[model samples]
Target: MILCCGEALVDMIPVDLPAGGKAYAPHAGGAVFNTAIALGRLGVETGMVSGVSTDTFGRMLASQLEENGVSTAYLARSGRLTTLALVHIENGGATYSFYDENSAGRSLTFADMPALGDEVSALYFGGISLVAEPAADAYASLLAKERANRVVMIDPNIRPGFISAEHTYRDRLDRMIGQSDIIKVSDEDLDWLIEGEETIEIKAAAMRGRGPAIVVVTKGAEGATAFFGDASVGVAAPVTHVVDTVGAGDTFNAGFLAGLNDKGCLSKDALGSVSDDVIHHALSLGATVAAVTVSRAGANPPWASEINR
Candidate 1:
């Protein structure tokens, strides 16, 4: 099973009302949550670890996960209010205004973390949970505990606005990256991490040197590339009508991991020795999944049947 650890929250998406004004519609979201849902929908054995409220919105989030076949056994239940992200769409792009203060997802501590069993093969980590206070520290601690036992995949999915302190968040993220087997980052994230001191490729190489056997750089619309050692392979994005790119990156992460898992290349040794063909296949799967997500209204990912078709 692949375990995803991070925040689970509700997104208040802007929607047109029947009357005249627009209102926010609640949708189950959060980077890690979306990835877990996508992985489950793709027929991957998946589970989630996070603090979820007993509130209505939290129930909605839990129901979405269960409906998609994601295990909820690791969810830490709490009476704290659910985190909410108000999404504003302009020109097909979405921006968020978060209300996460003292929310359930952000309230998790080291004590709230669960013990992992042998059934878990790979662990996925990223999103705002990497930056959020107590939860961030909790996740970092969990990563340290489990890094030696499982294959680790991380995507920073950086949101500059959410970061309270640049130095601290960077230090924490750098430490997590060192413990990861595979790391995925967007072009924007790369630029920010490396501060444009050198070329993107050079920066990626530096990141690979840190620890990750495979480093993937995603260029939205253009394509994505995976780097291992001195070899790299790039795959073009699949063609699809644009609706919204809410969950495209998260879905891509799930697809990439799912493909690797299917090929039995999810371990440190296997990933380190992975071939160009295998890398290409994973990137293709990721692009395919992202295409389905971008063609949807929200963060809705396709099921296994859709992918098989």
Candidate 2:
């Protein structure tokens, strides 16, 4: 099983109401949460580790995870309110305004982290939870403790707006990256992390030097590239009718991880020794999944059946 650790919250998406004015509709989402859901739908054995509320929205999040075949055994239940992200769509893209102060997902502490079982082969972390409060520290603690035993993959999913203290956030993220087996970043995230000092390939090479055996830089519409050892491989994005790019990246992470898992290349050793063919296959699967996600509305991902078809 692959365990995803981070925030679980509600996304208030804008909808065109029949009454003329727009209304916001709630959707269970969060970067890590969406990735877990996508993994489950793709028939990967998955579970979630995060502080979740017992409130309506939290229950909805939990129920959605269960319905999608993700194990909730690692979730820390709280009476605290759930986090809310108001998503504004413009030009087929989405931006977020978060209201997370004192929320269940943001209130997690180190003590709230669950013990991982032997069934878990990999642990995935990232998103707003990595920058949010006590929860961020809690996740960092868990990552440190589990890195030795499981394959670790992290996607910072850098949201410039959510960061309050740049230095602290960078320190935490850097530590996590050092301990991770694979690190996935977007073109924008790479620019933010490296400050455009070098080419994307060069930046990814620097990141690989930190510790991760593989570094993946994703380019929206242009597909993704994987850097390992002294070589890199690129895959072009699949053709699809774009609706919105809400969870496209998150689903891509799921697909990439799932592809690795399917190929029995999820372990740190296996990933370090992976071949170009495996890298190409993984990136292709990720692009296919992202295509399926962008061709739909919201963060909806395709099921294993759809992918198989």
Candidate 3:
């Protein structure tokens, strides 16, 4: 079983008018939530640990997760407003301007972390959950408790502009990084984490020394690369007639975790010694899922059959 712990929110995507303008269309989103839903849709055992809201939008988000087969036994609904991301789509890609701060997700506490049964193999986390206060501290604590049994994966999915430049968000993030076993970072995410530092080897080595045994750097269009210990493997992105890249990376994480679980190698140390064939299989799965996601309008990923094909 894989447990995803983070925010479950709504993305208000822009729909272009025939007259050449835009409007907001609400869709369920949040990096960890998307990954959990995708994994559940693929027939994998999955659960989500996060806070929801009592509002209608939050209800819709929770319903979507349940419909996709994600277990929400650990979900907490509060009176606070649900987080929102006003996503803008243009030129076949989407960019987000978030409206998150003191939202329900940010109000989480360490007591909210669900007990991972012996069946739970990995813990996945990402997005702005690492940026807020009580929730950030709470998630970091979750990583500590799960460090011995389950693999911990983190995708920063950084929103630099949303965070205060004055505060040391980076330093706080580094603590979580040190607790993770795997870290998936996009080119844009890396740039946001540390400007002008594009050296994969250097970044991977530095991050590995901190904690993560494996580091994956995703390059849009160009594909992605994975670093395990001192070795690295690169995989080119699969061809696709692009639509929108709303949940591509999140789905990619789901695919990778799915592949790892299928191989009976869900532990952090095991991932570092994966063979070339296994790495190729994992990367292919990730690319396939990402391709399916990019073809959709919002954060919706294709069914398992589409990924298999």
Expressed as tens digits, the lDDT of each residue in 203-306 for candidate 2 is 99889999999999999988899999878999999999999999999999999998898899988789878999898888888999989999999999999988
How far is each candidate from the true structure, as Cα RMSD in Å? 1.0, 0.9, 1.9
Ranking by TM-score: 2, 1, 3
CA RMSD (A), model 3: 1.9
- Model 1: what TM-score? 0.98
lDDT of 1 by residue, 1-309 (tens): 999999899999989988989998899999999999999999999999999999999999999899999999999999999999999888877878899999999999999999888899999999999997899999999999999979999999999988889899999999999999999999999998888569778999999989999999999999999999679999999888999999999999999999898789988779768988888889999999999999989999999899852
Better candidate by TM-score, 1 or 3? 1
Ordering by lDDT: 2, 1, 3
Candidate 2: worst-modelled 10 consecutive residues by lDDT? 300-309
- Per-residue lDDT over 50-116 for candidate 3, one digit per residue giving the tens place of the 0 to 100 score: 9889899889988988899998887887888999988877798777787877788989999866676
Regions of candidate 1 where Cα sits further than 4 Å from its true position:
none
Better of 2 and 3 by lDDT: 2
Q: Could you tally the backbone clashes for each prediction?
A: 0, 0, 0
TM-score of 2: 0.98
Where does candidate 2 stray beyond 4 Å?
A: none
The lDDT per prediction is: 0.93, 0.94, 0.83
Candidate 1 root-mean-square deviation in Å: 1.0
Alpha-carbon lDDT of model 3 = 0.83
